[model samples]
Target chain A: MAVSSQVLSYYSFEQVDITRFRIRPEINRQKVEAEFSRAVYPYITWTDGTELYAGDYAVLIIRSDNPKLCRSGLKVTIGAGLLGAEFEKALSGKKVGDSFSVLWKGETVFVTVESVKNRHKPELSDDMIAALNIPDVKTVAAYQTHLEKKELDEFFFEHSRDAVGYVLKQVQANSSILVTEADWNQTVEWSVNRLAALAAMDGMELRTMTPEDFRGRIPVKSYDELVVLMQREAWESVRMSLLGEYLAKQNGDTINADGYETFLTEAAAPWGRTAEEYRKAYPEAYYLQNEYCDYFRRAVTAYVRKNYFKEEKNEH
Target chain B: MSIKFAEASTFDNLVREDDFVIVDFFSTSCGPCKILSTFLEDLEAELPFLSIVKVNTMEAPELAERFEIHAVPTLFFYQGGELKERHLGVLDEDELRERIERYLY
Candidate 1:
């Protein structure tokens, strides 16, 4: 449910009178140490009297005075702008064992700060470095540098994906895409294979069952209607292919004949086919249409990453 | 509850002997097959006329191949020793009862 702006503006609300608060929030160093010691990845370090600041991961126990809202444990990153403003206000100054009550949707919501995680980079000892065993990363300092590089690579990849997706959406919105007969057949085959795999997992067989056979067995009656649905589903993938070709042409990322042959061989490997057999199975026009589309997307995305993306400082 | 067991050699004989028979093709390591086996055993009591034949695909590789059995727990229905219906996968108790009723009459 969307909370109104008026409710968000008012941080203070009617306080709840609890007959019995099940667990009182209390800051215990021993408990904190134990929790920290158990944590591995994104290692937690215990600190005294640390108020949960913005970007801090805090574990909270939330209970509603109204039985309808119920009680649940919530793991939240404080100041990530995810939690409601009022919820953040109630939690900002609170540390481990502190409790506060907030009004939400005309119901009194009681919140207890279970634990505030104050994280610090673990000591990069030889043991820690050895555990990772990443190539060319021997020292703790080297591992940190390697992580920074990997993070940069990830940032570029994410940005390129978003940019291509945005560009594709706009391009697709403007044009009419025609789903070929071969494309429709491929989609139906994929759908049938997926269904067969799921059935096999349940110790059931779907031996040699085509999409038509599957549709007949299910609630869906009309084969034509199923075809239409499959066509509608295939549009996005078809558009991706079209956009890939368009992007490749626009950016001059063209594949040579030799490169195409090599790609065909690699692509056919999963299907346990030689490139010659694969080419014969799929007509030249059909093969090139899909193959070039994939090649373009990969090429254009790489180009966008290399030329257009910059990494920013990320919150842990 | 009694479930008639079949090997590659006895498979034809088992189906031919019964007026209605269901051959359950399954593997030992298959978890869903185990559940379906228990369900079939319970079902045998409810439908005494329905002769259920259990065939281990591992033991009867030739039978599995002859039937083109790609996945485990495949059920092939036979009436008067002729293949009538084929179903692959775990059926819930209701579905199993309904399928059995469809062939029984």
Candidate 2:
């Protein structure tokens, strides 16, 4: 028996526009694994002492079992300063086999389409059909009617709650999204102004009330009661931070190099500071950077276990 | 058992009567307040010793403000016209009953 050649074509960085390039029809596991094994230069720099060039690169790997309905899926790694907005601009309109480049850092690095691998739509085995409780699992329509209506209803209800819960969770998780001194001062000032307006509505002078005085006059039932409410809100904020960090890590798949950069920018945006600023302000950001990666891994694991892809049935 | 409800204006009269009063401060818009009102109604059905009263904050803002109530629903246990214990937010049905039993009798 002869072994089949499973290796896909590998492209050097000089051949394509890595920023805008895309692979058509998607690639399967064999191609992806091979791509991962291949090494590509990530950074290129000028010999001049004043200039530095950094190329953030990632291997696009589409697992054979990848469930994305799109033509292709990808995994990307990139430098921290690039915003997702840049990649959206670069690759949104481009087709597969197209390539282009833009200035990155101080040097221009060429990017190209290395390979395009076609994939066959996967088939569900008899075991899968039994697991799905369906006689036919070949087409989307086949499985549509067999779904449990009540389960779907419960799912939607749960989904809505989970959506809100996720928001609350994100707020609670990302509590470490540090508010700078200036940002905190700004928020305090805004809150004070709003409070002053409320006081003025009651024919009270804003000048007479300080922040401490304002809190006192708010007529809380008790100190304990106020603390409890504030604590709940704080927890929600922390949850949001954790969720954002989780999202950035789990969905490291991007179509282009710019997309990877954009992800980093968004992941760090909530802190009301740059990723660099966060690292400078708190030594924890350094550890958090890696911790964020771990969070994404956990999120992806949970997401897979939850089987978020299956459409739920409608309930009465 | 008689279930008595006192309007904010009549609260003074009820307190002056030297009756052990359970005053519920509630708002119509609050979900917990609605639940609590039903709970109080059930308590009134079971307990004859204590007078259950409700004050709607929306209708009686002055009374709510007087008590410094920022949130609803709040419960106040009064004995001989003096506040003994106060509960803010939703209270468990059993907890409310226990508090009323300890304070009123």
Candidate 3:
């Protein structure tokens, strides 16, 4: 349902799930171990034909008729969907040394199960933290805190996105807002770069890596499909930004100097820098263009949250 | 109810009195600690047999240091006077419930 381009409804912020706020720390040793194991290079161990369990950790070698699709030493956990369905289907119930060929993108890709390793959940001890090489994470407690903070920040950011979505939906309902070609291009480029960055994090180069090669890694079929999806996402992003700016102007409430100062101080304190030091280092214009605008967008969303939304407090 | 602790000996007594104990290292200034305090209270009501031990790091620096508590809202689960698990940061109600259930069952 498309909203009018000009008029934003008041109930936008109230409709979404604002209660999805709590972020639990990954304290379960089993879960933490599984995640850590997947991130690292899986160990290789030859095994006889045995029924592969759901949680089996293994390294697979994929060979394809398409030169760009051929890949080797790809570490994956069984049944995680990190590898596409074909790879899973090709390997499931088959034991070590199992090989199968599947047609992908008009070419046959041969998959071979090279090695399967019995993964043990490493104890979240000081030694494990040292091996991780994460700064200031010298102990299990520190590591848990680090993970918790990361998850918590992600939760808040997601909540903020929902809040912005609320505003955008109302804005769309009221009037016709136009998407410019420049904005569309910027959004598409941003999506491409973001996807590349994600691929890089997973130890793959996206520019050279073909869609067929990255089948199990990402949820894209062809380059054209990726462009279409990114275009849709970029449009939504641009619309949200436009609505946020419009709502901020409509509210006529300037930034709270004290709140802004506290925000800046808190941000800088983690890096051992004072608010003044941070301000001196980064130009006021730069902060206004990026940080200040983001803060204002949140403020606009929060205004809707406070005035229109009923924060259902969880009694339990 | 969470028993307040100011030193190591008090913590020792608190743990010794209860078979299943959870020590919550919290600070007055920490917002998450305040939220967790209410959750822990709800948990205590749910499992009346469970005992909670509260240690304010600001008031008892030695106890905090002894426990290696670098952050507030850190939870230390104990069974039979031995540390079973340590969880730092905020936990949802379901997560807290699940943790207790695992030990109880």
Each candidate: how many clashes? 3, 31, 12
* Model 3 lDDT per residue over B1-105, tens place: 234564666888787675567888887767888888877765543233457888877667677768767666799888778889999888876787666655532
Q: Give a tens-digit lDDT track for model 1, residues A1-316.
A: 7431111111110121211211212234443343233223323343433578754656677787677655444555555334556776678877788888887557778888887765343644656665666788776667656655565565555445556555445445555555556665665655545444444433556664446555645444444554565556555655555555555665687643445566555444333334675454444544555665677556545545444532233411
Q: What lDDT, from 0 to 1, does candidate 3 have?
A: 0.60
Evaluate residue A309 in candidate 1 and report its C-alpha lDDT on the 0 to 100 scale: 36
What is candidate 1's TM-score against the reference?
A: 0.29
Please give, for residues A1-316, the per-residue lDDT of candidate 3 as tens digits: 6533332443344444444432322234554443444323222222332446565655668787678777676555555443456766667766667888876546788878787754343334566566778888787778767776565444445555655655546545554556678756866776676566555544567667777866986577666677788888777666655555555666674533445566555444323334675554443433333443465456646654454333345421
- Per residue, candidate 2 scores C-alpha lDDT tens digits across B1-105 of 134556777878775464467788876657788778766754543333346767777567677778877667888888878888788878877787567545542
The models' CA-based lDDT, in order, is 0.59, 0.44, 0.60
The RMSD of every model to the true structure, in order and in angstroms, is 23.9, 35.1, 22.1
After TM-score superposition, the amount by which residue A129's alpha carbon in candidate 2 deviates from its true location, in angstroms, is 47
The digit string of per-residue lDDT tens for model 2 on A185-204 reads: 43344444544544554456
Poorest 10 consecutive residues by lDDT, candidate 2 chain A: A37-46
| Residue B50 alpha-carbon offset, candidate 1, angstroms | 46
Per-residue accuracy of model 1 over B1-105 as CA lDDT, tens digit each:
137889988989998876668889887667788878867765543333358899887677678778877676788888879999888888866677666655542
Q: What is the DockQ of each candidate?
A: 0.02, 0.01, 0.01
By how many angstroms RMSD does model 3 differ from the true structure? Answer: 22.1
